[model samples]
Target: MTANPRGPNAVDRHVGSRIRLRRQLLNLSQEKLGEELGVTFQQVQKYERGTNRVGAGRLWNLARVLDVPVSFFYDGVNEGAGQPGFSEGDQTPIVDDFIQSADGVALAQAFARIKDSKVRRRILELVRTLAAEEAEATATEAAS
Candidate 1:
């Protein structure tokens, strides 16, 4: 079956998100990725936004450029329940969404480069403390 002309299918959106995720993980800009795929950066944007469906051959090319198997795009996609990349039992989507952002990707990359294990632990503790404080503040605001 074909998807609607105006909007992408769920599978297409899932694949696009996966593409964006992998591209960010590799620190590749949309233009660079588009160059590798022989497409314009605008086209890449469309693909990443799920405004366009990737064909089989194009997906194969993308897999090669991204250094991931084609199946990577479909890893979390659910075909049965009419939802793509969302499973009833899965709980980490919010985290995934955050990590998919440029700032989040940069943070992860910088954190990964830290050589000192102790420093990494300290940083983790600091972030946890900050998160706890923010949660408490939010709760207080909600109650007041």
Candidate 2:
């Protein structure tokens, strides 16, 4: 796992990366997602960068617009890497490979206004935990 402090902050970046990946998977454009969400592309960029915190309401709207589950954004986050982040075995190519595309960043920006700390932190823990577990499972499969 990465040596960097693993907490809410890292979780934000991971969320951003996942949003970007999903966007790519659906072949949607930043402008398009923004248009559907009734926001500018710049705002979406902020959301995907973790610069913006998505709120419960906005996340719902985004999920609806993107035709995905709200939980989708929280997917791939690992719970084991608490505040300290990834440990030795937890670190892997897949974790580092997650990247936030430009559009994904913009998408993230739209939800940047979520000011509730508790909600953000809770979401972070849940996503990170799931992500880490998935990564570990994948690694084990490959090794076997």
lDDT of 1 by residue, 66-120 (tens): 9999999888766452345444355437766777789988898899999999999
The candidate maximizing TM-score is 1
Give the whole-model CA lDDT for all candidates, comma-separated. 0.85, 0.69
Alpha carbon RMSD to native, model 2:
15.0
Alpha-carbon TM-score of each model against the true structure: 0.79, 0.53
- Candidate 2 at residue 82, lDDT? 33
Task: Encode model 2's per-residue lDDT on 1-144: one tens digit a residue.
Answer: 454343336566666666667676567888988898888888888877777666688888887877889888877667753345354354534433633444544445533566788977776799789999999999999999
Model 1 reaches what TM-score against the true structure?
0.79
